[model samples]
Target: MESLHGKVVLITGASSGIGRAAAELLSSKGAKIIVNYLSNKKGAIETVQRIQKNGGDAIIIQADVTIKEQVNAMVEQALASFGKIDILINNAAGGIRQSTFMDASEELWEETYRLNINSVLLCSQAVLTHMIPRKEGKIINISSTAARIGGAGESIHYAASKGALNTMTIGMAKELIEYGIIVNGIAPGMVETPFHEKFAPNEDRLSRMSATIPIKRVAQPIEIAETIAFLASDASNYILGEIINVSGGR
Candidate 1:
């Protein structure tokens, strides 16, 4: 990947997991980071501190990405701090628990869509204001393999929401590429993140799922961050409207 030096990156839900990892890694590569979080203020601070300690520039912003006004405000703050945003990581998501379709509530569906797809729309639109005029930028959406497999027994709602995200990624990629903005997505398989602790808390379940994976193991957050870093850099300049699967070959 090309150098990210001087690039200003805004990463949503960056308090922990893949977002945090991406922030730290990209910052290490010389990108100034805006770590956006909803409820995890402490994690956000830690992410910033780690970057700062490593001689990287970073700031934290609190925002509910699902809300348009909040997203706009966050972008404004990022611009105020960094002047411009060169990359936008639409990573803030997760609003559903493990539940079968028969047990899925309407509220679950609504919440999932708002968190996954709506947030992406709001953040991308808000950031585009800065990126389009410059005729250059990167937008990397975080999706999941469940989008293709249809999380039948658990989290079907979340799966559907990510499915919408994948489609939006392609659509936006085609629309924005003409203007020099590259829009792409990453569909990650099971990773040992807080997400599993919240939804699939059963250790046995995780182990079973791990055994089923072709690589016989789940991924780490940094593994996903590496791909994000790739998509965010000039190395992926020719890669557009694509959803790269980093699923251990599952």
Candidate 2:
């Protein structure tokens, strides 16, 4: 944990959920955080405020990760505040309303790919310019267990996007290792986050999902963030190109 001292981490969708948790945890571990948000300004600001109140450093920037221009600008803003980018966490992604692939619209497919997969590419490409020359950096992309379970009838498209991300992690890791950049991913199962509150609002939905897992529970955002802390540190330097499943053994 202390291995992150004085490092700079840029996390997308950092206004809430796992992204926000990673932001707070990394800051607490002595890394300066650049909180990236698309539309949740209030949540982003509060994340920064909480970090500062705890004697940690953080800055917030608003940008739609799906857009190349906006994604590039976000990286610029981070460099403006902190001269270098030490970590890049691709956590900005979402699924459309529940639907089978046959019922899914082309627009839904495009939107899902844009945010979940394209954003990862754009941000990683932009950050490499800074990371390559330094010969050291960590790029942790967030995947999902849906990639393995094929979305469990929720949305096949969401699964496809994460599957692509997991593949990208492996490809990027091989390409970037000579430069000292470690590329990896985390595929989380059901987690307690605003995402569930909005998408699975049933009083017993989490319980129902928990029943399927050996652990009998969904994850807390901070629990995922703890794994993120490990991947972001030198201690995990040896674990490259692998997506560590934080799915309670699902």
Candidate 3:
């Protein structure tokens, strides 16, 4: 594995799930972590405590990544603490609610758009200001396999938003690689995260969903985190403008 020693990583919505797992795993590999969260202060604190307990360096900051001003302030604070941000993981996002195209309201569409794509746009732009000057950085966006499969019937809006993210990842990578910055995305399939608890909730439905995956089971958060770690390291320098599918052959 490539050493992340001394690298400063800022992960958005890191209070729980894949974000938290990525922060912990990266910290174990020697990176200092900036844990960002909008709510769930308790979970964020717990993540930091776990890292500190394991002899890692980390701090927490709360920000609504979808808001430009808040995103700017969050990046400023991270810079103030670490002096330089070597990597940015755009992991803050949600599907909000599940609804078919016919039942999806305008409000739901707009809200999903803001959460899924707007957050990535604001966070990536905010960090580029610093990464550009140094001509070195890595940006990893957490997308979904839904972007490619179009998601289930109840999540058309969410799937559409993620499809946009995939396009943005490619566009940004193409535009930023000349500046020595690498931009990429991870499109994950079914995973055991609170996302399912909040949206699908029914254990039977989740079980059925898991059976459909070629792997015969959903992934763990750490499994996806491993991929994120690889992208953050120099080992992936030759790769860019690509959305890596971490799905178990869905």
In terms of TM-score, the best-performing candidate is 3
Report each candidate's C-alpha RMSD, comma-separated, in the order given: 1.0, 1.0, 0.7
Ranking by TM-score: 3, 1, 2
TM-score of each: 0.98, 0.97, 0.99
* Order of models, best lDDT first: 3, 1, 2
Question: Which portions of model 1 miss their true places by more than 4 Å?
Answer: none
Tens-digit lDDT track of model 1 for 1-250: 4689999999999999999999999998889999999999999999999999999999999999988899999999999988999999999888467777888889888988999999999999999998999999999999999899986357889889989999999999999998899999999998888987787678988888888789999999999999999999888899999999999988
Off by over 4 Å in 2: none
C-alpha lDDT of all candidate models, in order:
0.92, 0.92, 0.94
Candidate 3 residue lDDT tens string, 50-94 = 999999999999999889999999999999999999999999889
Q: Model 1: clashing residue pairs?
A: none
How many residue pairs clash per model?
A: 0, 0, 0
Model 2 lDDT at residue 119: 94
How far off is model 3, as Cα RMSD?
A: 0.7
